[model samples]
Target: MRYIIVTGTSRGLGEAIATQLLEKGTKLISISRKPNEQLIEKAKYLTIPFDFYSFDLQEIHQIESFMEKIFSNIDVTNVSSIHLINNAGMLAPMKPLERSESEQLIANVHVNLVAPMLLSSAFMKHTKGWNIDKRIINISSGAGQKPYFGWGAYCTTKAGINMLTKCIALEETDKEYPVKVISFAPGVVDTNMQAEIRQTPKEDFIQVERFLTLKENDHLLSPDYVAKAVIELLETNHFDQGGIIRIDEQ
Candidate 1:
């Protein structure tokens, strides 16, 4: 069976991705701060292999051990392929950088960038030469490529993720069994993160009204639609390694 390790599976795109993977009868391991009982029930009802682990990505230091715990269940000898989807992220401390709290800034960076780095590191280190398909998908944002007024922490971390993806791809270029890595920007979706954006004060986010307008006009994409595109790419392995891809372009 193909194995997928996904982060932030409690809701939004992550939840949609996990659900679809279950439907495909793939083995899945999800990481989130808390378990989504509905997903667990669905997996049981479908008799699909699923495992959920409660984890806070902000705990950067514990990430290695955490990954070890999750990887223990996989039987490398029987797996067709292995994938790591770093989907958990946050959009908080919506104020200007000067006014942002130290704790919030640190937490945002930890969750969005640091955790993925360590997780990918651990995954690569543990599965160095398995001679199987290995891929790491980092869920990124357009904000990473453009400057935004109040999204200093979020944008910087996402940009870091893009760079990290490229670096990984470059490092694995000459290896016989290279792990493919890419950053995926899923566009604006109607998720809780968008809600947070809509609720942000105009003074903090100058683009707040634009997002409100998008919501009013039903312009946001659905999580399931975006998840479908992501899963399609994964199932076919039709993606460019080291490239920064956008869902709209897919």
Candidate 2:
């Protein structure tokens, strides 16, 4: 009866996570800009839609209204409910810090960093009234840990996300709440996001050939695999205390 809310479920990693979680038996509340017919057929899924690219998370009011809508949909009387996977994000045509597109830069931070924080906070407030083990896991990237040129906005926002996770972890630990915040890095995968990154201007980004090689070499792990890994990571008791964890390079 664990209620799990996952954002960016329209396709790719988000969709994969939602699907796998459903198969594992959980009450899933999914968020995406568009609905996926396949996800709807899944028994435990309650699909909620939102456009991460267009919606500005800096507009806290908008975020509030959106959360209110979801909260209203939740059957709060239930005894078990808690989990959020803040996975929806954008790479935004990898550009250098200076030459990055202004709109894309802001959108990256808004979706990847700000919105996730807001949604988790809103959910936590809604669920503090419940009895369950609450957990929030952010889908972070390796780009945030090191310099990956052409990954401008993506890197910065993810780095910010890492800090946000730490901040929340500290707060929850101090409050002695059972809630645990996790920031996890999912390594390179064959995703549409990579297609966009490969398109970035040469001067503004990294060499496209290296990316091509990754794709060609079949090094990119399938999204489904990563999703399963997420479930494994969650179950491991390894991070039961909360903090940052990464899906290994495998």
Candidate 3:
């Protein structure tokens, strides 16, 4: 049996991926701020309510213990493969750096960058002795690779994740039971985050018009489409063959 853990399943891309994975009969553990009612009704899904906003992710030992408790009941011997999708993220305080508030900046960094790092470390440490194939997918963004005028915090966190993926992949390459890792960029999907971007005033987000154009021109890829593409990539040998990848490229 295959087991998968996905974060941010409250909505958007996370919801899409969780839905598809459930349909494929994968035993799923979903982590989100609140429980997803639809996912709770599904047979193989285990929803864990985790509020990343309030949690102190820097407390590594505590976080590791929490993750260990969550996975303690799973019979690792029966699992053929295990996957972790670090898909939780946020795009807030969308404004120039000079106008960005300190609290917002700290929150964004904690959620987008720090949380994933701790979770990834916990996953690797706990599963090290398991005999199943292990894989980690960090959901990244185009903003991570390119500098967007108003997305300083978002861009920096994503860039950090991409680099983290590279470093983790390098460290695991020659291990006896290597864990494959990939930082995946799911380009321009029609999610609530896009809606938030389009709603931002020009004064705050200088490139707001560009996002509006993408929406108007029907250029935004649907969440379902991107989720399917991601799953396809995950099921193939191509997954984790490299440090960073784009869904559009797949």
Candidate 4:
């Protein structure tokens, strides 16, 4: 049996991924600020095993214990593999860095970068003895590779996530059981995050018009489409460790 833990399952791509996995009969544990009612109802209707945790990833200090509790609840017997999808993120404080508030900057970093790192570390440490297949999918963005005006915090944090994936892969090279990791850029998706982007003022985001046009022309990819790609990556046997994979490229 495969066990997968996905973050940001309250809505958007994370919710779509969790829903698909449930239909596939995998044991799923989802984390978000609030539980997705649709997922709960679907899991019940299908008689599938589902665990939902309402967690604020910004609480970095409690992550270790939180992860421990999650693992403790699972019966690892007869488990084939475990996977982590670091999908929770925020694109807030979308303004010039100099004009951004200190609290918002720190919060963005904590949610986007710090929390994923801490969660990955805890996952590796807790599963150190398990010799099963382990994998991590860090949901990254194109912004990480290319800078956008007024997206200073978001861009920097995503770049950090890419590097973090590489660093983890490098460290696991000699381990008897290495957790395969990959950074995934889902491209422009139609989600609440995109809605926020479209709302950005021209002064804050010079490319605001470009995003507005994308929405107008229906150029954005659907969350379900991107989620399917992520699910494919999870079930596939071949994965490039530390590689940055893009949905558009696939």
lDDT of each: 0.91, 0.74, 0.82, 0.93
Off by over 4 Å in 2: 42-60, 240-242
Local accuracy of candidate 1 as per-residue lDDT tens digits, 1-250: 8899999999999999998899564899999999999999999999999989998999998999988888887887888889999999998888899999999999999999999999999999888988988999999999889989999999999999999999999999999889988899999999999999998999999989899999999999999999998887676656798989899888
Better model by lDDT, 1 or 3? Answer: 1
Q: Which residue pairs collide in model 4, if any?
A: none
Clashing pairs in 2: none
Model 4: how far residue 201 lies from native, Å: 0.5
Best of the two (2, 3) by TM-score? 3
Task: Give per-model TM-scores.
Answer: 0.98, 0.87, 0.91, 0.98
- Candidate 1, pairs of clashing residues: none
Top candidate when judged by lDDT against the true structure: 4
Segments of candidate 4 deviating more than 4 angstroms: none
Q: Report the C-alpha lDDT of model 2 over 81-125, residue by residue, as the tens digit.
A: 468888888887476778777877777788888898889788778
